[model samples]
Target: MRKLFRRQGEQRKIRDKSDLIVKSNGQRNSELEKGINFYAEYLKHLDACSSGASQLSPSDEAHTQNSDLYDGKATFATTQSELLQKLEDAYQRESNLEEKLKEKIKSYQELKEENVSLNKQIESFTTGQTKLAEKHSRDKRALVEEIVELQRRLDGLTPSLALKEAQIARLETEKDTANNQVRNVTNQLQCLQMKLDEARRDEAVISKLDLERRDEMDSLRNSLKRFEIEIEDYKEKERTFAEDLSDLKRALREAELLGKKEKAIAEKALEENSGLIKENSELCAKISLLEIEIAQLNKDNEFRKMNDINLAELAEIRESEKRSKLEVSRLQEKLKAEQERLHNTEAQFDEYRKKEEEVGQWHHRTQKELEGLQTLSSSLSNENKLLRQDKLTLSDRCEELQNKLRKKDEEFERMRDEYETVSEHYRKVLEKLELETALQHERAGEYEDLVNRVHQLSASLSRDDSSSKSSRGKRQTASSENSSGKSTGEEKVQFIVLNLADLPVR
Candidate 1:
């Protein structure tokens, strides 16, 4: 148990050391990141400072030279000369520092390689430990196999003991039966004596009794001897059976204990691997985030370049914005025209409704038809939405193009808008022409109804004319009859129209 705790403590120390290494690595990475940032920043500041210093120092040098030109030449030259020397020394110092930083970066790279090597070592060790555990498990399995064999033999012995007990029980029953027979024999003997006393007057009955008693006693003794032999064999088997059973039980217990230990070890190793996997995932995520940050910074630098645009590009972009807007307006007008046409069709549906009622006796069929129409309408509505979405996409594309070309396309957009407006007006006229189609349909329906009425009236007039010729004197003149027929037909049609209030017309 102390050894187990010692191993656990050693493992814990190793875990702690690994944790510390990971933490130190994180700190080092942070320091490296900071160093990179500082290096870049320092370079920026150095460039700015160097430029500023160079510019200012030259001015200072020129000023001193001019002052020396006014003052004593020798004294001014000496002071200017000392100042140049000091500037050169400071510049040399900065250069040396830059070189040192580069060396530090190189050292950081070496440390990174070392860290990778260490990680590889850890992985190999982990694999080695896993192989050991597998070997241990294989050994335990062999032990279990041996234990199983022992159990099977022990199980076989248990049944043998049972069989022996059953045999012993049968032998005991036979012995009891034999003892009863002996008692019966003794009673018979007493009875036989009583009989002999009585049978002394008759000698034949006594002779028969003696033969029967001898045969029964001899059979009872032989049975008892066989039972004794069986008991001895059973006792010997029970002793060996007890020893084998104890051995099998011990082996079974050992196998169970070994299996538990192997499972526990496997669980522990799994936990360690899982922890390592989690750490790796976290590291990968961190690296990805760092890469993303770098990309964002680069993009920002590029974005700043966009601000340096001169005047000409801005004008072109503005102009493109104008032409795209005009095209979008034309498509909007066209969509409006389509929507208006659908509305007019819906209004005409009211007239269809009156006809539907006249045919309303087929109400269920009408309702089913109406459901179909509703479904069609829903489909049309979906199509309309899709068309609208397509229009939106076109508008977005136009806007993006306009934004990109505003500075260069101003004249082009002005001309395009003029053409678009003309096209829009022509498209509206087409919509008006479609609306006129509804009126044409209504007129056609009215003309058909009028023609049908005239036909019916003419048939009635012919029947009246025939009946009059058969019953009365003479036929009327053709022109007068025609005028009379037309007038009467017109009046009858008007009366029919007045009576039928459920007309399908608007």
Candidate 2:
């Protein structure tokens, strides 16, 4: 019954130990899951922080997602620190983008103002053209009025000139008639002089009158008196002729003076006509020049319009160029950020892989520990079963010895006392063996506990490998401890065996 109770107690302890192991494994699994979740959350936060960046390409996004998967396995502290750095970088990029946008807007506004100024210039040109047209019309009206005034003056002068010409012709005819009359009068006077000479000669020849011709001489004297009277009349006619000739000469001089006056007036009129012709030529030249100026103005207006169109096109081209440059700059910044992120992710992945390798090694070591413990427990259980069998056989031997001693009590007292002493010595040896076996079990337990502690220390050392010197020191310490543990276990085994061998032969 005691054996059964003891075995039942041992089984209960084993069950309790297994349950404790299971609980511990569950807690460890839960902690690992929590750590993994925390890392994933940190990676997600980083993704959110970088999401607003405009420069991300499809390839970059893909790389980010892949990096997230890798980073999910990273420790919490590393993910948090890296996320903060990324957030700062993203903010800086955003600020740069905003500044570029503002510059573009300013350029656009300046272009608009320039276009407005060009329109105002075109309007001014149109106003100038209108003013030129008004001036040209005023000049044309003034020229027409002057031309009409000159025509009226020329019409007024024409009749006066014709009347002067007719007066000159009539004066010439009258002068010619007076000259012919003077010539006729001079011929008459010459004939009269010749007659007088003949009369004087006849008077000399008939100085004394004959008696027979007395009656004829008295009649001839009477005829001579009549001829003298006729002579007087002829002298008076000659004097009147001279006076008429002088009058004719004075009239010719007056006519010549009038002709000179008319000639002078005609010359004045010709000069005036020449001046008017020059004025007309000048006006015509001005008209032609004004037409050419108008044509030039029209051409200039067209050129200005073309220039405005060209300016607008140039402005558009400049704006497009600016936009393209801004986009390029933004893309370059995004590419830089992506490259930096990729670099950080690669480094994180490398660290994560190293940690994973260390974890795997740790799990392998733990499995080895569990296996070793299982073997030690099984060996202990087998030793206990053998000890129980030995105890049962020794009890049976004790019962037989007591029965024989009771039968021999009348015949061998001395032999009975000697048997008692031997039994007591055997009991002492069995007690010593039991105590040694217990000590061996306790040593085995201590060895297992030391192994577990060493494994834990090694795991901690692997985790802190960032400090190369410290990890090296820890590794050296762990090696020394492991050697010491092996040596102690071996010594304990040898001690147990020696104790077993030194037992008495009784």
Q: Which residues of candidate 2, in runs, are more than 4 Å off?
A: 1-311, 401-506
Return the top candidate by TM-score: 2
State the lDDT at 234 in candidate 2: 47
Tens-digit lDDT track of model 1 for 40-151: 6755754564555555667885675465445544544564575456446545654654565465556555555655665676678789889999997796556545443443
- Which residue pairs overlap in candidate 2's backbone? none
**TM-score of each model, in listed order:** 0.18, 0.19
lDDT at position 157, candidate 1: 48
**Cα displacement (Å) at residue 379, model 1:** 88
- lDDT (0 to 1) per candidate: 0.52, 0.52
Q: After TM-score superposition, what is the CA distance of residue 59 in candidate 2 from its true location, in Å?
A: 99
Candidate 1 weakest lDDT stretch, 10 residues: 497-506
lDDT of 2 by residue, 1-506 (tens): 35444545555654565466556555655755675687677768776845733357878767765676566546445756765565465456546545654655565456556556656766787899899999977965565454334334434543553453354345335434543544544454344344434433433333222222444444444544554454455445545554654555565566556556655655665565566556546655654665575566447546767776466655665575566556556655655665565566556556555655665565566556556655655665565566556556655655665565454443344444544555565565556556655654564454445344434433333333233333346467654644354334334434433432342211
